[model samples]
Target chain A: MALVRVISSDGAAFLVSQRLAKRSGKLKTEIETFRKSSDNSEAQPEIRIVTIRAEILRLVLQWLQQHQNDPVLPANQNEQDGRGDAEMGQSQWDRDFLAPMDLGIVMELILAANHLEVKGLLDITCKLVESKITGRTVDEIRTAFKLKSDFKGNEEEQTRLENRWCVEN
Target chain B: MDLNGTSKEVEEEVSQHYVSPPVTPEIAPTPPPPHLSGETCWDNLPPEVQEMVVEKLGDKPKLLRYRLVSSSWKKTVDMILERQFLSVWTEWEPFEQYPYKMNMHDYYDYICGYDELEDDDRNPTTGVILARAIIAGVPRLRPIWSHFAEHDRKANLIPSFDHHLPAVHNPKLGSPIPSNCLRIRFNDKIWPEIKRFERSRRAKTLADFVVKYDHCFSYLRALLLTDIEISPSNLATILGKLTNLRALTLEDTLLHVEPETQEENAVLPLHSNLSHLRIISTNSSASQLILKAYHEQVISLETNCWVPLFSKPYGNLKRLKLITNLKPDAQFRQGEENPFPALKYLSIIIHEGHVFEWDELSRTIDACPRTLINLYLDIEPRWETEEDKIRQLAMSQVTIPNVKTLGIFLPTIPQHAECLRRLILPKFPSVQQINLISGSWGCRSAIHGKSENETEVYDREEVIRRLNAAKIVAKNVERMVLELQFYATVCPKLEYIVII
Candidate 1:
């Protein structure tokens, strides 16, 4: 397998297998285009630097490395997977993986995963965020995320009035 | 001298009066615009990019926050959020009991009311108020209308929320309505127009209202109708308008009309894009109407009624799940003659009232046995007797020639293990997978008497022996799923065994 050097936005470089690296669709496309455009056969190409910031890219790479050998989940599998036995209980690995991250970092990672088309990472991050939000009060969410109370006086009052119907008894 | 002084003073006073301007109160200096801080406003992002972000957010709670970001973002969020929530809610919520009562008025009020409002306004105080109003208002409206509105009309409104609402409330106008005011303003703008056409007048009954609101039912892909009573004409009329529907569920609802009337009113044509159909019916005739429709339109059928077994078999079905009290008969037809050539999964529940005659079931299996992948048989123990022994023997003899997965549910402990022993050791030769689910009463003795270790050992050995024999008979057996209630006494030692 040919080795590909991936440089994150912070200028840190990591060598990964081309096959594994191709899991990130953006990188695959970039390399493919680069290969197609190059004319010199002996050209020692500079390492490809993906522009995603270093921290986000690191998390993405870590996830890709861990799930390198797992089955390639279909694009629509997130919707179709439902609540299978494998997903019913929290896996300890997933718990530890997500434990250290804050919501903002998790959100950024979700965006990164989506941009990279990393389905497993996107799913886990989305589910992690979903788990946090599911039963929480709006106030709790605001406090957790440090959201400002942007509603002007009665505007906030009216929203609660409207949301009242769907709130769980 | 005094006169001259007076004249000078007069001149000075006149000059002062001429130069004086109207006195105005000093205004407090306006505060400088509050610093625009934190993340960039979601609206400032390009529209296409915002859409991409919303798409990435999919239908999750992230979208909820996106809506609260700003008036423009709220519009985008509301557009997507309403449709997604309604679609999933319409399909799943009706059949299953919710932890809290879901009143349509309250739901509607909440969606309509909160959707426009700013996030801050929806506080505990207003939440209580709105909740009370929804709880009080929804119960008064008949249940049928609520169910009908949920499925047929809500989906069509998705596009309106997504496309129309944003256009009308262009955030670029600068003076954006706060989230709290948006919903009220939007409703003020639209609902009165809808109501003015005497739309509310036509909505005296649930069916009548849904029909009248047909203009709004176009975008729906999935619909759930539970405990709603509809006449054949009304049902057809309502169904006909929902052309974009993909999944349809009719649960515990009564369809009271003649078969001929139903045939005339059958709105779902053979080419309708419906893929999945689940009908849990208590009425036999109604079940038949639904099955007839299934035969005509659906690719997958799940029924909790036994009428299909007696009715002419359907041809287009790709999956069939039956839960009923009907007995199997020897002459029961199978396949396209009983047509299920495309069938992949078959699950049947067998109880005292619904036992399939042994020979009938065998013959049914023998016919249309091709393309069948998964089969589940559930037996109620109360009816298991000596008479059932002959039936069990017939079942053992029947060839499942191509079955890949098999599940058997037993209601209680067997009085005699002879039939099971005979059946397990060398029956159903082509089986690759097996699941045995035993009832609570059946495994009680084994659970109560033995130490946990002894229990585990005995169960494991028994399962291994049975499976080993099965492996010998059915050379392709590779996986088995065993679910026992209270009995840790028998475990299966298959290579891929899952104990539940």
Candidate 2:
């Protein structure tokens, strides 16, 4: 099979099959653009994703390879379903793929998947982040996200009080 | 090798295995990524990603916490909640006013331990609670009870109201629930205020709610109001204030003035931008008469009263739901002009014993033959023999050319089945979705003297067989929503069966 070169932000280059490279919409577009500009020759296309680091890029590529044969969902899949990604069911394998990653890596992977236009990966990663935030208190979420609470005395108390109705049992 | 490292180490192993195809060997478990510092957290993610994260949270309580996460997070979540009202009971309160004063006797009978049932043993579903509350002369409870009853019918059992009700009140309700059942922390003061109705600061009126959540009204797309206390002019004023409101639901609410009475009527140019209006009032059709200015803009309308539809032409109406009895008005002027030129979704729900209008319904359907996309007939015919004659005559005059969905919520007895095959299916040859819902009175077997459990199974099989035998010849049925008790196995291209 024909090969393609994928270069990550941190200067890591991996030789991937053309089929695998086509899984990433960004990579696929890049390859298509290259082929169009280069007269559709047999020469391999090199794709450099500047925003995604080597490790994150590698994880994204792994996900793409695993789901290489899966049917492509429409761009307006969420619109068609009339629901957001949180409600979409992911496969057991996809769940397992994301289960081990720490929150930091998961967030990074979400960014990478987003940059690569991998809807499935982006959806699952977002769902994971949502799972972490759901049922958690504001303080707990703040801790998880390492967010510095910006509200002071009265403002903070008011925000808390306003939101207290939602969590009240 | 360090026990804890960045994800880079983990990827190195994965890449090596991918590059060089390895023999079937158990892979070494990589060490977990080191604890992430405050370098990259949720806030640092792109705003679109943040929105996606929030969308995935789904539950209002979690979204509420996220709204206070940070300024940026608050902005994103606020936008979402504005467009979609996230408050569980904000638009749909269970009672107009609390059932405290009116039925102290029933309330006492249930909550004051008249039956001597332990609070833990009294695990009534929201349906039962709402039913009891409605029976106790609470007018506001009817709408809420209807909502829960529909849910109960869909679930085929009383769905636990555990999520909406205050869980800590084990004194009168079923099972002692954990305080965090609704995911909100109950303030020590508010709990007593909600139950006791004593000296405390709590939302007692819709006006109070409007003041508290004033920010939501500006961008609110939909609002369902059933509180009778709010007058028509007050509602009109409130509707006028909601700048971006698109859908409005008025249930059993009254409006005093008529729109035709231009001189005295204050609500003349109502929410003209409203695309959807739902009126579930059985007693008062005044609210429907008040919103005549919106006829040109309303794309969807659901009402029990037929006056709103028959009174004048609604040229832009794309959907119409007749929940109440649609009696043919004697004054409805017959004309060659077609109103509802863009009408697509038509749902006529005739309850038991209500007379079904054959000629008027057929005329309505004939008007939108090419435009109608979905036809739902939720009718419990007064008499099967009479319905057959009416169906044949009515259906002969109409044909929905572009209809893709056909939902029939009627008894699937042989006679009705024959009528469906003869009258309904052929008229909608383009239908790809068929939702065979059982009538509100449960399956046909209930009337045919079958065991309760066996009824559902028999009905499901009967429906499939009858539908298949009807032989409409429409290929690739995609969706079939049946009663909650039954699962569909007949459709060829069935993606999923909605159990409701």
Candidate 3:
């Protein structure tokens, strides 16, 4: 296997096939750039993802490896489906893979997936955040997403009055 | 430390791609739980990411709720809503306190228990709905049932509706709803008719164009644009700038020029919230422009004139009111296919000018979706000569299985009760309510300059006859409406006949 070494922000390193790494659009560019400059064609490529922590980086790679043979969705396909990309290819196994993460970790994954241009991970992670807010009240959303109301003074009251019109039906 | 899980053995086939799973041993027990530092984590997601999260929320009402999370989410939600409503034109109740409840009996009781909010009596969505401006001139709060029906016997009893209109209570039947609305009344110089309506002292209350009304953009739910010329780009920019509108009603509007179809929308499909589209007195050319821009989002459509736009069944339409002719042509696709798969309410308003016109309506309704619940028609002004047309209407093989309310024009011509009864009761096998209305739009057409309602320039007897006509429809239609329901033998489930 043509292998590449991936390093997370917290100094953790992962080795995966270069093909799997290339699924992340970011990693593909880095590996191709490494090949262009290298003296030895046999040399393995190394990529440092400075913003993603080890825990989050591992999930993205695992997701990429699991769906390696699946055709990457063209980025423009979101509007045509009338639904989020998370709905198009989400498998039971993908659901199981996401079931245990805390919403906080999911946020980190969204950031990392977006940073790496991993459309599938970005879609599913953003979808997970959306599920939390879909039918929840403001206070419930605050607790679920770990958000706190930061409005002070009459701003809070004005927002509350505005919230009165927030009918779901 | 061995985070990389890959065998040192290189693939013999260098051209093939392979993915080996990562075996990062140190990351097995996931790092500390997010709750330890999660409180501010959501607050910390970059604005773009936060926008992505709220965009996922999707539900417009829930998007409004998401604003309460923090000042950050509020700004993001506002920006998202503005972009969302940019193409939005809704005809829904903006100040509706509750969602449409299925079990409306209990829902009515629940709402009646609480006092209504002190209405500002200013915004167009509520206290001074334009209907009040024309009817009676005295500002009586438009009754609740007019907008949403199926509740108390009291509301049902006082059943006379637009003597000009003639139907059971529909928000659209009386006055246009202002619950979620922005009414753009043009200056007299621009629109001569509006100048007459606004000449009254209360005109000041109905003032303020959207350009100057700063508070409208963020919460704008419905837009009522009158007397404006809309081109594709001007409208897209005006509507797209800042509106969460789900309903749009355009009256006496004109189109400047037909631009070539623009490229596919470059804006991200960030919001698909638009639902209600009503184009009144607009030219077919201009009407087609609005339809082309909004076909994807419209669920309820009310067009005063029928345009030949349905080449294929535009999907997801639930409520359609063709307030004029059902296109005197053979456009409705026949055969086994149901063209409207989701249709729930259909109202075709054309009287029997000729005998053949009645036959066309029967053929038009044959392709109705099995989901139809309310079917209303306005047919009148014939003597015993049109009995065969009514007979042809009853004999047609059309049988709607789910209609709860059937509305038709009850022609008050002497001794024509048999035709009205045969024309209605036999077609809808599952009707529970029959709304028999008696009136002609010709007598007091709101759009016609010679309308009855006084417009500083009240002409001749039209105003006197219209004022008395509204009272007569409410009082006299009750007896004839009650007599027509003797179809105890026909529609067994029929409960009440309301005269509108």
Candidate 4:
């Protein structure tokens, strides 16, 4: 079996099968380009993800290994429909996988999933983050995200005043 | 974060817009790996990821409250607002329960009074200004038109807004047009409420209301006028005024006959912005009336009606969707001038009243332009199966070689497999993909197999029994090879036999 070594930002290395690594669109492109550009025919490709640190990179790999056989969803698939493919693809395993993660870590997973071009992971992670924001009040949202009100003194009142304009109401 | 060699090579690898920049102090490659437990870094997800989260938060009130979370969120939320807030589908219905009861004249005047949107704090990103006074669209029309609104995804976009209107709508009803366009629908049920409210409050006719919200309607890209009994002159005036409308759906709309206004057959002036026109469920008279009004400017037509265009085809018709029985009209015949010269996609949806007439169906297929790349033939045979119809439909030939994606949606009945083998697959000699979307249960099971093991979705023996019964063999089709519990193998030319 063909093998590819995936390295994370903190310099941790994980060896996965070429078939499994190809599930990540980012890895697939990198491997294909490596095969074409390298002088040796039998060289195993090594890809280093600079943005995603070791922990988040491992999480994304675990997801890819679980869903390796799943059909590659075209990245624009979710954008084609308004309701999105998030709810339909999310399994019990996915839920349990995400249940114990902190909001901050989940936010990091959203970034890693996004950069890796794994549409399903990106959608599920974004949906998990969306659940944190959907029905919560503004202050609760601030608490959930750990964000302080950076709005300047008068801007908060202006944001409050402008909030009354044309929405569904 | 490594700024040395790996990051630059990675930049060339990823999409240009998605390239992670070398870590600066403010925008470090990421927030130091969530390991820095006390660091305030969740909001530091790139703007694109933030926007995706906002889109998942697909409602108005939540999206609005999302702004108050922090300065970063407000900026990211505003970006989504700027892109999606191009149009506000305001149907000036009564929302007395809404605490901010502003008048229509006041709202329109204020927005128009300010001219253009500025880069100020007051831009309501997803704010669909619900009209307090009766102005935009009438109430009965609300059910049909709400599907076009972006906030209709959750249906619970607002708790207090429009609650008084009866909930005879699906919250997740898909929007037909793009989210950045305005939709205006008028119906009869609105007048009584409007009349009562008009006498006591802001009373105005449809014409007056259109004039009042002229600035709002400037964002109007698609207008659906259905079952309107308004005066002909009034209809002409309203149609004439909406110059920015890109698509118009006329469904028994131009029925009014007031001779005092103009001649009985007076042509309505054509606006240049009109390119795609749809005539829905039009009878002979209605079809004629629509063509007489605005047939010259139409370049694309999707209609169930098929009478008026027989003699003079719109020479530039690029996309056409015909809904009718399988029997082809006399004009759609072989060895004739290509009526739709520029047609790229042809969709024929066979209504329920179809008969077993393969010769006519074949002739209709022959009339399709060679340049056509997509063909969708949907024969919705619900409940009962007519074996004779299936056989005849199978005999119907599809000869468009350029057709890359052919979608055939029929019942999941067993006989249709024979039709696919003998008739459908052979004709599309060099087609790329075939989306067989008929077997609802069996197909769903097959698609689920792509993600999870779903051999039980359809009993395996039952599917094999049906396949064997249909006499589906490799020799029958050019390259057809059916796997148990799934679809056939896709050859090099035929890339995907996506049975879903």
What lDDT does the true structure give each of the candidates? 0.45, 0.51, 0.56, 0.54
- Candidate 2's C-alpha lDDT? 0.51
lDDT of 3: 0.56
lDDT of each residue in A1-169, candidate 1, tens digit only: 3445665544555555555566677667766666678896444233444435555666777676555545566665546665522253235776787899877677667666777767667667767765665555656655555555566544444333323322222
| Candidate 3 chain B: 10-residue stretch with minimal lDDT | B106-115
Best candidate, TM-score-wise? 2
Among the numbered candidates, top lDDT falls to 3
Q: Residue B275 error for model 3, in Å? A: 23
Q: List the residue pairs that clash in candidate 2.
A: A167-B183, A167-B184, A167-B185, A168-B184, A168-B185, B122-B174, B123-B174
Q: Which has the better lDDT: candidate 1, or candidate 2?
A: 2
**TM-score for candidate 4 (chain B):** 0.54
Q: What would the per-residue lDDT of candidate 1 be over residues B284-370, giving only the tens digit for each residue?
A: 655666566656555666667764443454566666666556544332452335555567677665543544444444554555346
Clash count, one per candidate: 31, 7, 18, 6
Residue by residue across A1-169, what tens digits does model 2's lDDT show?
5677777655567777766676677877888898899865898887877676667777887887676555666678787768664346478888888888878888888888888888878888888887887788878888887778775544444545434323332
Fnat per model, in the order shown: 0.02, 0.25, 0.32, 0.25
DockQ of each: 0.06, 0.24, 0.15, 0.15
Winner on lDDT between 3 and 4 is 3
Better-scoring candidate (DockQ), 1 or 3: 3
Candidate order by TM-score, highest to lowest? 2, 1, 4, 3
Docking class of 3: incorrect
Flag the better candidate by DockQ, 1 or 4.
4
